[model samples]
Target: MTDVPAHVHEFDWPDRVVIGTVGLPGSRTFYLQARTGRRIVSITLEKEQSALLAEKIDEILDRLREVEGNRYSVPTSTPVELVDNDPLDTVEEQFRAGTLGIGWDPTTAQIILEAHPLPADLDEAEEFDAAASVNSEMLRVKMPVGTARAFTQRTREVVDAGRPLCTLCGHPIDPDGHTCIIPES
Candidate 1:
């Protein structure tokens, strides 16, 4: 629609951006939203994708802090906002998320999030970095240290909110319970 190249979309400096989800367990829909002034863009993606992105962001920040000092690592997730945590009340997503990239802009001191459509044949794709670039659809959001930290924390909470896992087996246990056949000792 934009008639532009497949480069990462830019939200150079958004006032706020956070990763969130909607719906209950078994029907949960993960989303990433970026807001700048009155403009807001939301993209949906698989739950695993969100989990991995959040984890990677935290890892990147941690490593950056170790090498560059406290400037980037000083920000930690803030108190969770009840309104933001509730999925039933969030904005309608523009589209489902696909490939995700977390990057740091040293000059601006902001974290960049690039969410794009999944490559047509990811199974045959040789590299993840190449896959994301092949698609023209992308939504990029740039957030400061504190915002990025909050996004990471919130994402973790949402992903972990699924059904509890069985002790013997790793899969989630249904309400009726599970046999959990892990070869008894």
Candidate 2:
């Protein structure tokens, strides 16, 4: 695998927006921004829900354009009356079932999710391995090209901050001191 370009960087919370794709057909792309911390997420779907979502986005952009400034106000979500099933619940279930693969870039504070075929059972090690490899490949290939700019900007900030903490010990140390305690035979 090619190294993630030097430009890709980590993101800070609240200030960053994450974009990703989801659903079985891989047709749904979701753009989520964290509000009031990561607990409250505002989502904007693109090229997924198709006509309805497109219409809503167009309406919002139109209204914003009318204001003659880069900024405009729009409702984050619309309340929907469900007769029986909750859409959010269904979506959550699919996520938990591994029908979705969620990727989060800490530097850019962006999340990318894609609809993927999952292993039939978590206990099946062989199947899990195959599924995981496929998922990883898909992520590398399908990652949005547009996010590179934001990712690069965030990475620069992180690099300026200094080196990362040790993944094994979670301790911050100078590069020369970064040794794993695990003995090699």
* Most lDDT-accurate candidate: 1
Tens digit of lDDT per residue, candidate 1, span 1-185? 43443554568787556667676676777777777777777777888988898889888777776775576554544535422454423476665665667888887778788777655676887765544454566787887776777778878888898778876678787666677778677
lDDT of each: 0.70, 0.34
Please name the candidate that would achieve the greatest TM-score relative to the true structure: 1
Error of 2 at 96 (Å): 5.8
Worst lDDT window (10 residues) for model 1?
81-90
The residue ranges of model 1 lying beyond 4 angstroms of the native Cα positions read 1-9, 76-90, 119-135, 183-185
Q: How high is the lDDT of residue 96 in model 2?
A: 21
lDDT of 2 by residue, 95-152 (tens): 2222334443434433343333344466766445634534422221122223323432
- Cα lDDT for residue 30, candidate 2: 40
TM-score of model number 1 = 0.76
